[model samples]
Target: MNATRSMLICDDEEELAHELGEYFASLGWHVALAITAEEAIAQLRGGLAPQVLITDLRIGAVDGRQVVAEARALPPALCPALVIIITGHVMHNVTAADLDSDFLYVKPVDPTEVLDDIGSFLAGVAPPPA
Candidate 1:
């Protein structure tokens, strides 16, 4: 297992968050999950430097954008290698470009597709558009 492969998944839906975490962990990734933006931010600020950050766009009051900002604000070495934003309500927010995210996915997202994206990125190959 690759202990060094770590990721943070933040979502207001507790079950989905845990499910995603379990899937990633099963694949040998060190996964951290948070049900709120504050919790996610705290984890990041507390020094959990994950290589990947996957956050729901509407995560309670703070939203995923705030979490993304927090992650990007970290020091260069600590910043996530990839930022993926998932949202069921795509019309409620600005474009992915505005968030500075590597990928923007609409809800009902297939976990395997997310895994594929991460794999392609880490392999220095661009994943197909979302």
Candidate 2:
């Protein structure tokens, strides 16, 4: 993967966001952290284009799905290569049909696993089986 690869992580949990940001940064990725959906949207609108975006499904007032929509609505050149959605809530209300994210993960997920998946994607390799 290119050392300049960048990712955006949006989560209301400050500690988790910071942890993921630091971990990806350590891996030499340009990591951006957003604590709110509004902030995440602002970053995207401000022309911060990341290759990957990982966001919690339920941000304060706006949903992560909204962010996905906004991202997808951007010009082709500005769209993220992948979108991963994370949430602690039950799967009842959330469906892939609604969000159209490349992947969806429940809470308590291993950060390294996420990183590995992302690395594999960027390296043009298939991700290992779960």
Candidate 3:
């Protein structure tokens, strides 16, 4: 991960969220793990404007796609949060043209690669170690 860029690991699965958050935290990202869609929204409401938002496809009642839409519906400045969609063992073939996400990957994703992708777009946001 870039020692720059605030990131959020959003998934209803607590264990999975912690695992991903820990991995990115090791790389020096200011990462927060959210176990529900409401929590994710609360984080944003509390001024945690993450540059990158990583979420699971099937997150309990609120799926990743819906999360993106809700997050985008926030203030204009938060409209284009770079989203990384995570899916299960068998991910649905969703095209980029069909969604407004930066990328999508099936589990188990490589933490290193995820870091690289976030780093690629991090212009100046410093990643604070959690």
Top TM-score prediction, candidate number: 1
lDDT of 3 by residue, 1-130 (tens): 4565567888877888998898878767778888887788777777777778888878777677777777677775654347888877474577644666778887888877877776675545443435
TM-score of each: 0.89, 0.88, 0.80
lDDT of candidate 1 at residue 13, scale 0 to 100? 90
User: For each candidate, what is the lDDT?
Assistant: 0.88, 0.85, 0.74
The predicted structure with the larger TM-score, 1 or 2, is 1
Q: Which runs in model 1 stand beyond 4 Å of their true positions?
A: 92-94, 125-130
Per-residue lDDT of candidate 1, residues 24-76 (tens digit): 99998989999999999999999988889999989888999999999999997
Lowest lDDT 10-residue stretch of candidate 1: 121-130
> lDDT winner among the candidates?
1
In angstroms, how far off is 69's CA in candidate 3? 1.1
- CA shift at 75, candidate 2, in angstroms? 0.9
Order of quality (lDDT): 1, 2, 3
RMSD of 2: 4.9
**lDDT, model 2:** 0.85
**TM-score: the better of candidates 1 and 3:** 1
